[model samples]
Each structure stands twice: as structure tokens, then as C-alpha cells.
Target: MESLVLTIPQVRKIVLEAAGLARKAQFGIGIEAVYRIIDHLGFVQLDTNYVVERAHHHVMAARIPDYQTEWLAELCEDGSIFEYFTSASGFLPMHDFRFTLPIKKAFKAQRKPLTQAETNLMKQILDRAEREESLTVGDFENDRVEASSGWWDWRLRAS
Candidate 1:
């Protein structure tokens, strides 16, 4: 067997190319490009943390020119992609959906059993959903009378 050797810079170049970062617009910006990029990368970790922009959007914009943030939601809406936790929270190609089952099974096996109150709450929510043709967060009564302090807050800002 022969072992290949490469210098530090060469290895770095290879890694960058594989990650679609060796050049700008490595994949043309569009929905198709989004799918191709996700497929090639295997997974693009999702992050909700925002300083300037969300981590996931920053990633796409870096590698893809004219990247639109809405494309992610559109892909999800059309079932072209899905969000799941695989080592990390991220998006995966829909064709790879079956691969997630084992991870889900493992999580289910490892999780603590739900308490009676939690179980009842789950049943109640499920029943309500089944009976109602339409439901909204406003339908629920809670002590959240105050504005949310985190991401769930939907207060729009002036443009």
C-alpha cells in the first residue's frame, strides 16, 4: 500500500475546496444551489444565534453569491430540506431522511420517561390539535402575559 503525503498548505486548500470555500460563488446562488451545497457538505449546522446574522445564513452567504435568507425557509416548506439534530442542529437533504431514524431511535431510548403530568399535557395538546381544524399560540392560555425576552418574541421593528 502507498501512503500519500501533502504539505500543510495543500491539505488546507483541499479542505477549503471540499467545503465550497476555495472560491467565491462555488455554487451558483439559488434553490438548486442550496440543495447541491447541502448535499455535498452532508450537513450545514444551524444556529439561531444572531450578532449580525444567524450562523447558518452567514455560511450560505459566504459560499454563495446573491444568497437570499428566505431560501432556507422555502426549501423547508417544499420538503426539499429538513431540520434535525445530527451531532448538531442542522439541515439535511430530504433524500437522506431515513438516515435520521437511527439517531431518533437512540434519543428515544436514552430519554427519561415522561412524568404523569407531562404525559397528560401531551395527550391534551394532541387531542386539541386533532379536534381543531386551525389552532394558534393565542388559543392557549398561559402566564406569558409579558413580552417574550428571547427568540420567540415576534415584535416587528420599524423599517
Candidate 2:
């Protein structure tokens, strides 16, 4: 197969234009604009840091300048969109969930033999999730904690 090559400037322009088009930043906003944008871009990657604003929200805002963040939340609640890992935190079409299942299965398969205490910890998490409609790591308070500022530190990350 033959490959086409371009100068640095040409490559940069193409990349910039592609990035803008992918985000729909060059266009105007609409009520359901996020769906089109995410669909076009394939996935709206989720980010934890908010030194300015959450990544997903910022990405949507650039495209739908007049749209509200709550709209994205509603989309998630209505099951129109879903979150999955694609090299990063990502919001993708609900139908794409099937693609991520293999990753989950592989992760489960690779775990080391669990110590009895770790097994109990896993059991507690599952039991609570079964009882509660929703759950968080903060609910897992116990001696089995890392005793440091991480997920168990009770910080709510956007995903």
C-alpha cells in the first residue's frame, strides 16, 4: 500500500479543522444538539479535573453554546446515553455498551486470587448495590481502606 505525506503546516491545518468539525464548534446550538455532536464524534470523553469545567460539559458547551448542562444529565437518566471506558472515561451511545463488555470480562478474569478479606469487601459492595438502586465507594467505610486520599477519600468524580 502507498502512503500519502504532507508538510507540517498542511498536517496541522487538517488536524485543526478536523478537530473543530468533530466538536461541532463551528455551528450553532440546539435543544438536542449534544446527541448529534456525540454521535458525530463517536464519544464524549469524561474527565475528572475541573480546573475550568468538566471536560464533557465543556465539549458540549462549545458545540451548543446556549445549552444547559442539566440537559446532558437528563439524557443519561433517560437512557439515551451511557458511560463506558474507551481508553478513558467516555459517554457513548447506549447501544455501544456491548462493545465494552469484553473489557469488563477480561478485567474480571485477570484478578489475582482474592484474600478472604478482599472477598468479603467485594461481597459487601455487591450486597449494598443489590439493596440500593445506586451505590458509591464512599459507602464502603471499613478497616480495609487505603487510609489515603483517593477514590475512597469520598471525592465525587464526574464520569
TM-score of each predicted structure versus truth: 0.71, 0.62
Off by over 4 Å in 2: 1-17, 21-28, 112-114, 119-159
How does candidate 1 fare on TM-score?
Answer: 0.71
Q: Name the best candidate (by TM-score).
A: 1
Question: Candidates' lDDT values, in order?
Answer: 0.86, 0.74
Using lDDT as the measure, which candidate wins?
1
C-alpha lDDT of residue 77 in model 2: 89
RMSD to native for every prediction? Answer: 5.8, 5.2
Residues forming the 10-long window of minimal summed lDDT in candidate 2: 150-159
Scored by lDDT, model 2 comes in at 0.74
Residue 9 lDDT, candidate 1, scale 0-100: 100
User: Which parts of model 1 have CA positions greater than 4 angstroms off?
Assistant: 109-113, 120-159
User: Candidate 1, residues 54-152: lDDT per residue as tens digits?
Assistant: 999988988888889999889999999999986679999999999989988989999999999999999988899999958765676655577878965
Residues forming the 10-long window of minimal summed lDDT in candidate 1: 150-159
